[model samples]
Target: MKNAIVTGGGGGLGKSICTELSKNGYAVAVLDLKIKDAQRTSEGLENASAYAVDVRDHSSVIEFYKNYGKAPELIVNNAGIARFNKLLDQKIKDFEDVIQTNLIGSFIFASEGVRLMIKEAKKGSIINITSIHSVSPGIGVGAYSPAKAGLASLTKLMALEWGEFGIRVNAIAPGFIDSGMSKPFFENPKIRELRGKAVPLQRLGTSEDIAKTVLYLSSDAASYVNANEIIVDGGVIHSVLMHLPRE
Candidate 1:
């Protein structure tokens, strides 16, 4: 059975990714900071286990993988957080937190996971969950936009360095995915309407929509695809930019 690791699996989008992987017959490791929640998620799956990991801590990630015994064939760096504040209002701590979790954490997990996979001589796939903000920037996203942009660049770099070892690296950039983190904003009718109107699909993205893309890139169907980003934003990027000319 192919072994896979889904970081942040205790949460909404991450949980969906784990479930999708499990449905596809892979043995999944649900890695999250909350042990109880991770275990709870694993219990509902057939061939899944739980691992508690603090993605920000490199030592924690290394130890967690070491204890898991076997190298995972797939690893999704999905743990991320965004604290919104205008550049003028942003504190140093806020910027540090974003860089630490979103960018550095991904590096730590990717490094450790790749080391294990190499030791096991397994051909593996690594998926970094980035944001459309990686390309498109906005106000009140000082740290978030840069962090994701860094991740997107890192994705390409890793793919170039690891492909010779049969390791593939790619990124999934989602646009306004409807999840617990975004539910509050979507609850505001104005925000909801604006989001719908902004996208060509006239609706916000669902976690499953993003998960399906993850499944594709992790499976053999995407074997020849590497160092690329699959955007799951329902054409929002183009819609917004297309209107810029007349403004």
Candidate 2:
């Protein structure tokens, strides 16, 4: 079976990605900071194992690759966090934590994971989970937009450097997903409806939507698709003009 590693696999969207990979016959290593959460996600799928990991720590990441982490055919850098506050109001440390988790964590994982593949002479796919905020910044999301933007740039760099070795790198930037990291925000029915209507597709995105995109990028059909960020936002990113009133 093909081996896959998904960081943040305990979270809502991560679980969906794990399930989709399991269904497609990948033996998955679900990595999360919480062992219990990771175990819970693994329990729902076949050939899935859970691990507690901090992708931000360099030594810890190296130790993981040396011990439990397999040389994966696929790696999904999905672990990230956000703090809600304006730049002036947010604590410096909170902004740092957001950048550390969303950007630095991904760098650590990709660097370590790709080293393993190099040793094993494995050429595979790496998908970074960016956000639509990477393209367009939003107010009150703290450093999330910048972190995701950095991740997008990192995705391109990985592809540029690793493509010669047949390691394809890509990204998915989801917009207004009803589940996962944005779930709490969408819990308000009125706000959810309003946001849904703002989307050109007339609905919010889902975990499955992003998962399927992941699956597509992991497949052989996408062999030539590299260094691209697919936006699965129900066309919400482009609908700002629709909301602008004009007579």
Q: Which digits, one per residue and each the tens of the lDDT, describe model 1 over residues 1-247? A: 8889998888878888988999999899999889887887798898999989999998899899879888789999999888899999999999999999999999999989899888896589999999999988878987999999999999999999999889999999999888846767888889999887788988999999988999999989999999998889999977855657673
Measured by TM-score, the strongest candidate is: 2
Q: What digit string (tens of lDDT, one per residue) describes model 2 on residues 87-134? A: 899999999999999999999999888887877856989999999999
Q: Model 1, which residues run further than 4 Å from truth?
A: 241-247
Q: How close is candidate 1 to the true structure, as a TM-score?
A: 0.95
Model 2 regions more than 4 Å off = none
Q: What lDDT score is found at residue 101 in candidate 2?
A: 97
Q: What is the TM-score of each candidate against the true structure?
A: 0.95, 0.97
For each candidate in turn, give its C-alpha RMSD to the true structure in angstroms. Answer: 1.6, 1.0
Q: Candidate 2, TM-score vs. the true structure?
A: 0.97
In model 2, residue pairs whose N, Cα or C atoms come closer than 3 Å (at least 3 residues apart or on different chains), thus clashing, are none
